[model samples]
Target: MQSTYQTAALNDDYYYSDILYSPYQTLPPVIQDTLLDRQRIIVIANNPSITQAKLEALLQPTDMLVLFNDFIHAEFFAYHPSAKDLPKLLFFRQNGDSLLHFGLPPRSNNLTAILEMTKHATLGMLFGNTDYQFPLPSDDPRPNDDPITANRVLEIPKPLDKLLRSQEHCGVLSEQHSVVADYPVFADIHSSAPTSGFLLYRLLLAACLEVQQQKNADTPISIVMLGFNNENKTANFWEGHNWAFERQELATPPHGVEIIRQY
Candidate 1:
């Protein structure tokens, strides 16, 4: 069966939306296992100031990296120059975009970029819906930009509608659902609405904390968040997303996660 994320790709329609609700369940099994295996799980955000050189100095071959959204775009490659030369680390592309099969005979640019990405991620480039802040400029390769491109970026993530129907590697996250399950308090705290980074942050932290509880502090897992901002950068902020709350959350790092502020 497909996992929640694999079914998480593209989307449309609003009646079926989960309404910012989140419930966690062990950080997706594969992600859980990844926590147990890697010494570190670095989540890279597209804040631009975060460069590949900076990441390379922090990452090891045994470490795991997570990239989402337009990290596959050329801008990312330019920022992280010689990214293809980075250590052979295992990684996960927990897609910030929902997974909709854009059937165009598979662009090598897409596939090659995929392949070059720590080998398209040993974590199998998991897919899931990360909440989108409307009116934001899209960086995805498409015919146009903004509303239309972002609209087609997903088909409509009926995640709650199709739970656990995809493979473990290609899992789906009910976005807010995935967050609430493990970190209910975090998810429910003061309208903490944001994008996938918040959800993915909680998801990975949940898994790491779980393993940490097993007393693996002899070699504790470290989570470093890079290229993240604590304030809203968009001209139009999405309603209901408490940027202040999210900023607070990031400012006071949780689950041993470190924030390297570049902006």
Candidate 2:
């Protein structure tokens, strides 16, 4: 039982005005409805232009736990009295540099914790970059000195793992040249450019679609692509390109994930 929802048209001035710039106190009803209905939700933002004020404003309404790429962004919510008071507003930092620099409270970096968070996340946004290394502690000696390794590893969680595994292993946009992972769920995009944000957004969408299809779930999934500007003006790898959501006939891939692209 697959159903389609339409995102508001993008304004010419802003990259994602309908979503990123929408009023915080009263978000679009569609967004509210989807949040209420969906079993799984993932929001991806990589736009460097996004400010602390904007992020905090958007987060004010939800009880979602956020996984930030660095302490720069995580600190706002992590330290704010209001944010701290919300027991549901948990945060995790993926960047070891920030973790080591700030010396914040440690949270479990185990795969089990990640899986549990993904399964239960009411509203989640993952920032790209910050170099998400996995299965290794943030304080690991190897990454301490030479943070940007000649070779890097990108980790994919279980929910996303299931979705990517269903595809034909096209390399991710980021690690295209590197040795790809042998497993269907893991592979490198092999590019030096910063494309993780875009890739993360795509993967999150794919994962949500896969879950809905496989589970025969009827709840609607709403996606807001934050920080993508016209002409790929942002630092994301896909420069000179712009993406928008256009209404089209719903088409499901072999993996049973339906994707809606701009016409």
For candidate 1, the 10 contiguous residues with the lowest summed lDDT are 100-109
- Most TM-score-accurate candidate: 1
Model 1, 31-68: lDDT tens digits are: 55655667776777756676655665766756666666
Candidate 2 clashing pairs? Answer: 172-189, 174-191, 175-188, 175-189, 175-190, 176-189, 176-190, 176-191, 177-190
Global CA lDDT of candidate 2, please? 0.32
Candidate 1 CA-lDDT value = 0.46
Best by lDDT: 1
lDDT of each: 0.46, 0.32
**Which regions of candidate 2 fall more than 4 Å away from where they truly are?**
1-48, 60-68, 81-194, 232-263
